[model samples]
Target chain A: MSAESYENEYGNAKNALELKNITKRFGDLVAVSNISLEIKEGEIFSFLGPSGCGKTTLLRCIAGLEDADEGQVLIGGEVVNQIPPYKRNCSIVFQQHALFPHMSVFDNIAFGLVEHKVPKAEIKMRVNDLVDMVNLNGMESRWPHQLSGGQQQRVALARSLVLRPAILLLDEPLAALDRKLRKEMQTELKRIQKEVGTTFMNVTHDQKEALSLSDRIAVIKDGKIIQLGTPEEIYESPRTTFVADFMGASNIFSGKADVNGDNNILFRGDIGLEILLPNNDKLEAKEIKGISIHPEVIGIALEESEIKALDSWHTVFKGRITEAFYQGDFSELTVKLNESDIELAIHLGRGIAHDKEIVSGQDVMVHWKWEHNNILYS
Target chain B: METIKNATSPQSDLVVKNKKKFNVEVPLYMGPISFLLVGFVFAPLLIILFFSFLKTGLYGEIVYEFTMGNIKEILTGGSGIVFLNSFYLAVQTTILCLLLGYPLAYYIARYGGKWKVLLISMIVVPSWVAYLIRLYAFKTITGTNGIINNFLMDWGLISEPLTMLYTPGVVMVGLVYTWLPFMVLPLHAAMEGMEPSLLEAATDLGAHPVRRFFRITLPLSRGGAIAGSILVFIPTMGDWLVPALLGGSKVMMVGNLVAQKFTIAGNIPSGSSLAIMLAATLILILYLAIKWGGKEAMEKLV
Candidate 1:
């Protein structure tokens, strides 16, 4: 739901929430360096990273939980530096499903409403509506502990959303759930964001979670946002070695840019092979060492004569398969061209690979759509 | 029965199967813990249960006859005042402990740095010292010429030493001091178990600091609060030492009443009955805590 909204096509509104040179330090450890980003109104922006990457810390700074040593936070284009969270029109759902254990589900959702001094019948109506939105109905009277982990998360969501805040912040809200439940919640959260039209900022370490839920994901690493892009951009065209590698495990080959040219950059390595990088003129690698292709993008053994077929001129090649393995429905083949190790995983019918008797150490032609190849720098 | 089992369904079946696989092989936290629990936890309780009902003589010897008369007399008169007082003191102690210990726990949990281990040790190690020694130290501090008054006098802040010790107020002070660490430890345990993101979530949710404390911190650490109170409340109810040393004779708590009945009045049966009543009241409080926790609270976390 979110991915489709602020896709690369729609780079999100200029700014609803903006962080300026924010930095957080805990004694000796710097949690977030001087980094900044702009989140659009009603945008489902996500801070994506591994655990301890300061995504949650950054979110906390936005929430006013942790003071940023160096930064400015603007909400709705207003400088909110002096404002406390309660006055900032934001609500947050925590990773542990921080539903008030003492209150019933109904009361838990109604709590913020009560704090804000909303009217009795209106609070009831809003709470019930939220509970229904989260697919929690009759369970309102139950205590937090009585609900399943998933149910507790829903209540947490309900509790935060019922307050009608300008922004809803979620800190790994689905981290506690099992895989099935997490996916279900990701969709539910997306639907809720769309329905409420409230900008949702989520912090998550899970790549899939961020990709599935975020309209735009800011990839944070070592206290800084290294890349901010849509899931498709992040997946199809990762900008750095870390971005390329961290997105998923892939076969990486580093080389020197022997020839730099427009639309095609020729690369050479100790492997005795020269490869052409199409549409990549700049690579920060002193030795064209930054170009890469995803494993899924590499096609299996096919016809060498087919290389002459009309297509992007720079994509077809011949190599020898050195290793192969059946990864679920698809078969992955490791091919070697000169000294460079290239892994080509092809999506195939489960039985076809063995039926065709594709073997390792066999000479195979490698082919890919030009767009699947990405040239990484630094 | 088949229908009932069927109604329980796949999830319950999995639970039962796991339960049989694990719980059947060993009782919950078995081996030394099991043996020691039966030895220390139940054996003394069984003995006390037996003696509370046993008839007693003027000489404080058991008459070996079951009677409710002793239990009745203790519940009836001025004795009820002590009952009310014990309850009032326990509630006060619980509240004060929560107030003092919660911030201490929160500070330790969130902000306590190199001093955290030290602070935690300070909270816990004092508990390891003999209970009598701690109470005696409390006595020395809160006495007529206690440390506080003496310090005030030496500083010429007061003309004479004030009478601060040996009153209901003194008893409460002692109880709060004694149980503050109890509340801190469990609160630390609860707050420690909490993800820091939970508080961050509240803050991000636009909850003010005070609102976050009430809405998030207080509710989440309730387990620790309940555990701390039970730890402090159960023992403090029957405590003779604090009241005797700090509260003096006029303070006359239920514990002092029990002491008075057995030692001074020479009424063994009445003391036994009062002891039994104390046990009943503790049980009721525990029941209320469990009920307050609600059905969700009963889930035994594995």
Candidate 2:
């Protein structure tokens, strides 16, 4: 579902969790400011931000690990602000996995069931089902230390999921794994969430992990949500330069906006270039301070003659290539405009930049389409 | 490519090399400590074992003749009562220490925050003073004319100074007081070493605070508890001074019996036999505790 619909799902029957103006303070420091969110039922939502941005604090508030000084937390349409973490049916997978070092995997997963006074026969059935679901069949008797990082992660998941929590809050659970394993667990986590149909709220500082896994993301900054949107919407149409910069690598230019002829809006960038925005109702604002465009959306033409020969529908500018980096699969060209200190980052395919000998200090032409440009508020 | 392979493969290669030399290297590193252990500890035990098998002269001197007289007499004699009394006192001390020390340890470990070091030092500071001096402080407190009785008498709360000292109950108090730090330190360390996320996970999984403590905190910190219990129990059992001084000559433990047999009675053979038997029993119990409690108990002792 889109982020708009998820936002409208607040206080409705379809929401699994709702936080209303939650604010948690640690003495003088506001760890989480006045924040409200509604996560749709069974949706994989993420609180994405840099470190110390209160994303994790907000998740902990929902889990009742930290008491918010001022707000209400509702789970399944029930106001559970006063409920203890144990009474609330929300399980959290810790960043460290936090598997019990003393207990075997089977016992670790069976602990919750034992606590709930579930029958022995049913505990065995549920434990086995979870062990199999996490792909820990023969490793049941292994202690947490015996398992690999990924295996320990699976056990942590099994241990929490066995309780059948209404929502699973994961605190950077995959941050410990290697790149390949992290990617694998990302898909594995999504698959398991689908199979179990539990609402998942994940907190992470890794932008790629958030972008790849979340159905919708809340980009938080300074203890407040800067933007809330689907992954594509957040990456493509960030509400502010902060959201755009935090979401991914983007070239942001400070500018003033003005309506031109017809329905077009022109942003007079301080970088000595005017970028055009096609007819859009959102662009009706009188003035805007910043405009953002993804680095990957910009194209670089090496030859000046080739740049001039390019047809319309392209807003082009000449700049000197100050730095060129040949990444493993792609290449990045940082072009400094001749008129100002502002540099536009243009990402190119490995074939274009690497196959051809591109170097710094060379003059290059940068261009992008009208629609790929986004106006940033402040 | 070769450099990349070499860099990546070195760790496994080093591990294999270390594994190959492990047997020889372990003993080499441990040789000096083992030598001291064997010389000071095992050699003394062996001498005691030899003395236990000897005959006693009329004047309590050691005789060269080999005999089982002392060993046989111990089982049939009133030594069983001494053992029972010592064990009972030790059990009480251990239980009292655990009951009193656990919550204190938990609070210091979990909630002491910036004052954790200060709180731990407070528990440890009393023990740093001479042992006898600390015991005497308890002695003064529990005496008939001690602070509590004098205060109560002055307030007309009692007709006379109560008989608060030199009793089995007073001895228990002394033992628990003396051994409480041993319980607190280990329990605090264990509680501090515990992964806080485990408790959070337990709470997240729908276990209440009490259930979390019983199922997670208590079970996980059991190593420390058992370690603390053993530390208090074993020492309290063998202690003759507290029972002799505080229990007044009315109570006697195995240590007092052993002390009397060697010094007052001058029966070296009986005392040696009794000491050996106690040592053997303690070793057996320690072995069983280590086996049952897993690696943490053994590690804590070391």
Candidate 3:
């Protein structure tokens, strides 16, 4: 949601966090450009992008770990641009997890409470509760070096959460873990966020992590927000080529659109071929960009009779398979249209992909519903 | 599991094959160095040990009697005071070096950035000058007729020259000046290797700057601190030049006492015994430091 709608829906007092036109520059490079966003109370929001794309920079600016060259950051609708990180009421889990190597697990969790001079009994109770929450109950007395990477990450998460800050910022908290551990931590993170009901702002370059864990994701590139929406919305209707490419592999065609009727437009691909799109009012000019169809959305069939069985709203193509790559559970077919230079990627699962005849140079028909194609405006 | 096994089994087989190759190469690697170490190092230490157990003759001859008298005297006689003074001076110099050098190392590591190499070089450049020359330079600076006294006289800050030379304090200043780089270099290395994100996390966790330094930076750099203390403390314990030149006759350390027995008094057995005692003290200090600092301390030196 936009900041205005967020403020209206949750009221100013409950908006949780907001950044108004925040920008940060380092010497000759603009690390984060003019970007404004809002996260609602108890929401799990994510900034997703490749490295050097300013997603982490933006998170740091919000956490007051970095001073933005322009604009204000708000926590609970209170402007915190002048406050230091300690006073901003936000805690961060660093990308390295940053567990204190010298301190025991219990002390690392109790560090913030000790700084605040909380009562000894209360500190013990709180740290124990957090240790249980992060599933590190019995290992409290062990040093950070003795723990594994996953356990260290749990300590880092508990350390930040024990303070009960207004928001928790995570900078690729699982990036250092193996793929299997990363998936496990993703679920653990989601569960903890739900239990605590704290606003979470996670930054990651892994699209799968953001898709599976985030309540809403902001797709960023070149220090700007390319698109911000729910994961399903972004997956279904990416507004830019970068978003489509970043989100996943897709058949991308940049072309001009000519109005066909009341609700239809013909997109002539730059490389070749033409496809139909349900007209969107946002596009007023003939110049069209980021016309993409997800590979999974396109269906493959061996016979022309099967192509005829598809609905009228579906766009079909007669193509020859240029290459067939066999993945363990599926096969990916790179298809070049019979009379056009345009290539479309089709993914077929094990049942349909096991056919002996579906090799390179095999003739096939590809089709997808018009609604599955995203027509982006320049 | 399957992928890892497939990838590593061949590499492990190659490594096992290489071990056979290493067996043939061992003589080439170990020959000259082992021979040199045994000839020069172990032979001299054994000779010293032999001398230390012998009795000293009246005219400084090597007597044929075997006795532990020299070692007994060093432990029980008034020479204990000299060892005490030497240890006191070394500890004081180490504390001062730590106090002054930690901030310098921190500044260079955190704020020097592009100028870090230049700044570290400045600390190291003075070592290139001869050690005796540096001591003489200190003498000129602290003497009654030196530049400091001359400048004070010209400025009318004092009517006569202050007795800054040949004092225990001046000796300490010299020792600290000489060893400060030893302390700073290791600390700078530790601070430079510190992951900056750790400090950022500390700040985000509601720690003020001073608290963060005390709680995080200080503890994490303990390895460097311990290593630096060993580097400065051990050598200062046996250093003769600083005490001899800067301290004059007023401040006689264990090193000067040992040197006097060997050269001025010409008592080789007595001198070797004294040297052995000093070496034993240094070893004790090293053992204690390594025990306290753990493997992390030794790792930082590497």
Candidate 4:
């Protein structure tokens, strides 16, 4: 795919190593669309998206493997659009552990040094030091096939890091590994990044992996960053429907919003509920447009008769339990509101389930605090 | 009864053993086929070895006069130079094939068009013509007044016919041309099988394009090199027709020597001895090549 959206915000700050209005196109397809991001020094930044979402393409563009057709790439405050990958002080670890099978582990790690005309003594010392860092001692004389899969990955890591590049780019480096090994490598990768003190830009589809390992995550959908935030912000305050779903599989309900008293939004239709949302300071009092409720905010009721009073300002829904699916500690219930076709998804902890143990087709009430929902504009 | 005891005992072990016994069909057929192959292919070599130790009597029958002198003479006599010449020619053919054929193979493997079968056919279909005929064709192509010389002369590019044919240089060119596709095909396969990510990783690690090739591509393609060299070298060493036809009866190689001894020299015992020595030397070269290649070569990694 291609990145072709960011083609004009062209500033070449060295701190940025920026992608200025960069766009990539492969004929009729757009892989990346108008992505502008500045990777700061010593930050473990991640480009996270689903498979085929063009995270890899963006990484390749930065590595200079694939050139940006519409914009410039600035490295060290100079535009490196014409520079080849080798001239850039960047190293990439591919998903597959692509060790040179003919060489010993030592030679494979020392390869960049040899290419750079490094002294033999320095090459030996550095390779040995990296081997130790990767915890692959005594494997210098071994061929690639002789080692296990994990060893091969470490060798690949050592091979890239031995060059001591300004930034390290990893293209799904854990993709080839088994589940347990992938987790281990992820931790090892983070540890190595910490030790090296180099900026790392990683591309991965594993959202959990990015959340856990990265200092800041750029959650991408169709190659555009849906949200750029820390792990806590991405999880707790997703800005878009895709980010909300992708980060943790949250249920999204779309509805129109009307402002009521004191920054509260009257969210009508499909449960006919109302929610109070944080008021946007820029918009005038009457300008807010849409409201959303996360699944966790909706709770199940035993019966419609349990409420002491009905308040229109704080909304509630009379619904029937259409479906309940137990997922260990929480049960996800699909509640059909009245005679409407709309389904309200409610997540219930085991401690706070419905009072009367409602089965499918049984009448129930769904309610939440109006302030617990979110207000959206545009 | 004994039948009752058998019926009560476990039957699963019998079934397992029966299945194991049923797996022998492959070795059963391979056993006899391997024997036939060995008998037909190796028996002649054994006969040659046996004859080399015996004398050909005046009546044209082998009189078993046991001798090691024949082996000594073949290994150390005037014929030794002929063996060296053959070795030199083969080495040159192998090197020339690598230099020209490698790039061709790499290009076709990486940038080959959709009509690969048709393209490779262009190289291979020419081989269907007789080897002897091809040698004669080359002989004509490089002759003093051949098509090339005539074209150059008619185009006013040269004043006179150049000495283009019937030399060692011409023979070298002919040998390389005939075996070039052999080198190209295997090397191409090796290159096509290679993972492009490896090259990318090399460059990402500060290796320039040329450095990447030497460090990653060359070493990875070593298996192809070995296979290609053997494909060209083995036949070129033994091929006497091409050299004799192209070099204009020049005393070209040990292959010519082997031909002379076997056909015209009237020395059957010496010819047999030299043939055995040639086969032995080939086996020795093969052994050394394998021993040096090591276990990393199990997957050719082309």
Candidate 5:
């Protein structure tokens, strides 16, 4: 369908960027399978996946750097599939900054303006404003090589922002910075996006970065998006085992779900463990093959009596502590259940009673409420 | 503590032994090039300088009397015209080579892909054939009854054979053909060293293809252009073979004038002075080129 009709039919007039059945292939390998998504104006969207999962390829297709073999890319309600990258009006900040080593910081930021034939005075004013916005004031005359890695990245950001593109594509922009600097830049990037009001589409493999920085995320694997939702939805209600594992929910139990009396469902794990699933209207009891519980949701008690006082809705597992790790803010205990050989990862906050005294080989009971279980169908 | 000391002592001793061996190996590595520089390069230059200040006998023998007449003769005579011709031709050849070489070098560096080695080899392999043989081949192709004229005549394009030889233009063709590879090699090296992402960044910044080339590619490859210009200019200015074979005395360069002075007139003193002047002029030009091209050009050439 034509871009106008597609937008009219879908009522996506407010979407800053929309992809319809976008697919890219590299010879025999499909780098990006048929994927469709819409990003609203002034929203920070991310494509999160492991390396080589085609997140970068999807971003490139959106930026017009890579042509989609089959599909339409509509930006601001105009189809831009045939337009080249320069004319598409979507700027990109590359992973390595890709700053012009030959040009000074001011000239680098002014390059797009000069190409567009902006007046000289206005170009200088816009570049100066961007330099100040990205916190690079008084560095207009320095070469790219003279700046630190973080500083160069800021220059790159300012250079792209000066164009005021309809959509800004960031390809692993913070993947090169140190952890602390990455966190700092994450905050800076959010502030800049808010101030500019331009839609941001970032591609990264870091789950934490995507969770922290993105308003909505599409988790991709093997050239297809397995799930697309807000950060909280993707984290708390993963629909597939891959999404669950990718979101850091390390406790996945593959089992068979059987319906019980009065609409109750019980999951019997293959490893001889069992749990009562919470009531979910959308779940098919026969189709649920597994379930995932986040590591932080599982609680540990030194004695069975400690958790026995709790209500009946909590499922308890008697286990012995196989290993303990003392992190700064919390402690991690690996519990091997006595009923089965299954190991469960539990996190105990520093405020928990006797958390510091927890040691390896200590007997313990691991328990979690049924409401914390996220059912996985496949 | 004793064990740590014992462990460290052997390593220190080994390091000292390696240092001693390295001291001896340094001269061993530098010996051949140093010998060649002193024996072939410096010695001939020093002899030329010594001969320029001496007098010449009637039979082209070097007379052991110091004289300033040879230098004075050059300054007062029509050698200025010869110098101007050489300068003009050198500049033209450098410009032509740059115009033709930059695009070819950029293409090979950027898009040659797996065939890059083969393409660059095609450029370099022809230069490896004997220079005189290649010049003769070029002459045969451009001669009056050569392939181009014959082909055109067969096709009824021209009525008579054109005067395609012994002109300054053919001399230029010969000079450029002889030195084009020198221009391409350094240019290719400089262009190949550039990061491809810079061009992509320029494109993403709303610069079109032509604008991207001028703004990003051209400025980044300036080092290669300067180095290629120098590589073409210095040799073309002093070349005698092209003018001798192609110009046939119709267009005499400074090299031909110096050759006639030494060979035909038997004026060794005058020839040496003229040669010294040419060398001095080239040195000055090289200094200026390096100054204008800056450190980037120097680094690329080295």
Candidate 6:
């Protein structure tokens, strides 16, 4: 369909940006394939994926830096595929801040306004307000090189925000910062997005950053979004093995499922393990091909009586501790199952593992509630 | 106390031995370049400075009598016109080279891609041909019966041949052509050092192509432009060959006048005084250029 018709059909006033069947290719390799999504007016939405998964490429398509081969880009209820980047109402904060080294902080912020020929007094007011917003109040005359890395990023942010674009594209905005500063900027970025009331489309490979900062996230892999939902939904229930693995679920087992009784399904893992799963209304027992359990949710006990004392709803397995890592806040124990050679990662609170003497080569019983089991179809 | 003294004595001896070794190594490393600078460069300049204050004898020989007549003649006489003409030519050459070189350098740095090195080498390769021979070649191309005139006449574009050589314009062209590579190399370096994302950021901030060029690309590459101007300007001021071959007598520069005093007129004192003035002028210009270009760019060059 044409961009105009697409805009007219699906472009609601609430949606700040909408992309339809956007496909981009680099020579023969497809960098972004047939992707369609919408972002709300004031939402902090993120595209989460590993590096080279084409998340940045998708963001560039929205920014008009890269044109989509077979789709339309609509912003604020207008088709903008034919428009150049300078004419679009969206701005991007690059991964490397990409601040103009020659221009001062004030001039850098005022650059877009000057290009648009805004009034001189208004430009000053806007630039000063942004400098204050980004907390670089007294650094109006300082050059980009003189500022620290975080400070330079703030200037880059301020420079983009001064234009008041309809949507702000952040391409790994805090990826260049060190860990402590990245956390600080994540909070700062959320605050700034709220204050500006502009739609934020962020791209990042850091899952923690995405989970913490985004109101909604699209988990992308191999140039296609495999899952899109809120952080809680994606983390609690990933649909595919890739999403499960990428979201830090290490104990993934592929298996066949059979109906055991009226409401219970017995899953036979390929690794010679068996577990009972509660039958859900959405998925039939035979269609389920895999399961993932979060490492932190698994409980370990030293004795069979201690495991037997758990509720009947929990699935239990006997295993021996193969490796134990004592992290400062938590201890991680790798347990190899007795019935199978599968190794499961179990994270216990620091004092709990020390009190139990969970060392390597110790026999243990591992159990987790059935509700914590995340079923995967592919 | 006896053990402490024994320990200190051996350490002090070792420190003295290292210090002596360093003293020998310093001169050993610096010997050749230091000798060349003093013998070939500083000594000639000192001799020229001394000769500028000596008197010229009747037989066109230097008489070792202290006099400032040569300096006074250069300062107050018609040689001032030559200095002015040389300055004008240098300015014109620098401006022309800048106009031509900026785009070429930008193209090579921004879009030359895999051929960037080859393209830059192409610009530099022409300079490897001897300077005098290149000027002669240039003369043949623009001479009265040269390629351009013959082409124009063959095309029936003009009834008569155009005067293409021995003019001020021709001299300006030759100087710009000769010194253009110098301008390009520095500009290319500056532009190459610039992060390309700056241009993208500018575009994302609503700056169009033209505005982006002026606001981001131009100001960011100012260091290169300044360095290039200095490179082109200094050489063109002292260039005597281009004018002699292509400009004939119409376009006389300070370099040609100095050469005349030494070779044709055989006036050592007069030539030395003119040379001193030119050198002083170049030094002053270089100092001002560095001050204006800022220390950061000069540091990058070094």
Which candidate has the highest DockQ of all?
6
**Candidate 5 residue pairs in backbone clash:** none
TM-score of 3: 0.89
Decide which is better by TM-score, 3 or 4: 3
Docking class of 3: medium
TM-score, every prediction: 0.76, 0.89, 0.89, 0.84, 0.91, 0.91
The lDDT per prediction is: 0.78, 0.86, 0.88, 0.77, 0.88, 0.90
* TM-score for candidate 1, residues paired by index: 0.76
Regions of candidate 5 where Cα sits further than 4 Å from its true position: A1-13, A350-356, B1-26, B295-302
lDDT of 1 by residue, A1-378 (tens): 434555553464557788899999999999999988888877888898888999988987887767789989888888787787767777778878766556789987887787778899999889989988999979988978789988998998888888887788898889999999888988998898889988899998888888888778888999999998888888777888888888873745566665544656666644544566564544444634556677766655556555667466556667777777778787777777644554444444457576657778888777767666676666
Error of 2 at B239 (Å): 0.5
lDDT of 6 by residue, A180-290 (tens): 999999999989987998889999998899999987889998899999888877787888899999998888999998875577788888987788877875467667989
Candidate 4 lDDT tens digits, A1-378: 011211121122236357787788888888888888787766677899998888898889989999887787776677888989988878888888788777789988998888889999999999999998999999999988899888999999899898888888888888888999989988998899889877788889888788778777888877678888776666656666677778653555555666655754455533444444545443454444444466877766675555545454345778888898877677888998886777778788866764456467878888776554554442
Q: List the residue pairs that clash in candidate 6.
A: none
Model 5 lDDT per residue over A194-291, tens place: 89988899999999999889888899998999998778888988999999999999999999988766577888888877887666574567789888
True contacts kept of 1: 0.53
User: Would you give me the overall lDDT of model 2?
Assistant: 0.86
Regions of candidate 3 where Cα sits further than 4 Å from its true position? A1-13, A280-282, A354-357, B1-77, B155-159, B295-302
How many residue pairs clash per model?
8, 0, 0, 15, 0, 0
- Interface RMSD, all models, one decimal each? 3.0, 2.0, 1.7, 1.4, 1.8, 1.6
Q: Specify the poorest-scoring 10-residue window by lDDT in model 2 chain A.
A: A4-13
For A19-119, candidate 2 gives per-residue lDDT tens digits of: 99999999999988999988888888899998999988898998999999999999998998888888888889999998877688999999888888999
Question: Where is model 5 chain B poorest over a 10-residue stretch in terms of lDDT?
Answer: B293-302
Off by over 4 Å in 2: A1-13, A259-266, A271-273, A276-279, A282-286, A302-311, A354-357, B1-47, B54-64, B295-302
Candidate 3 residue-wise lDDT, A319-351, digit = tens: 889998988687888999987788888887867
TM-score of chain A of each: 0.89, 0.93, 0.94, 0.80, 0.94, 0.94
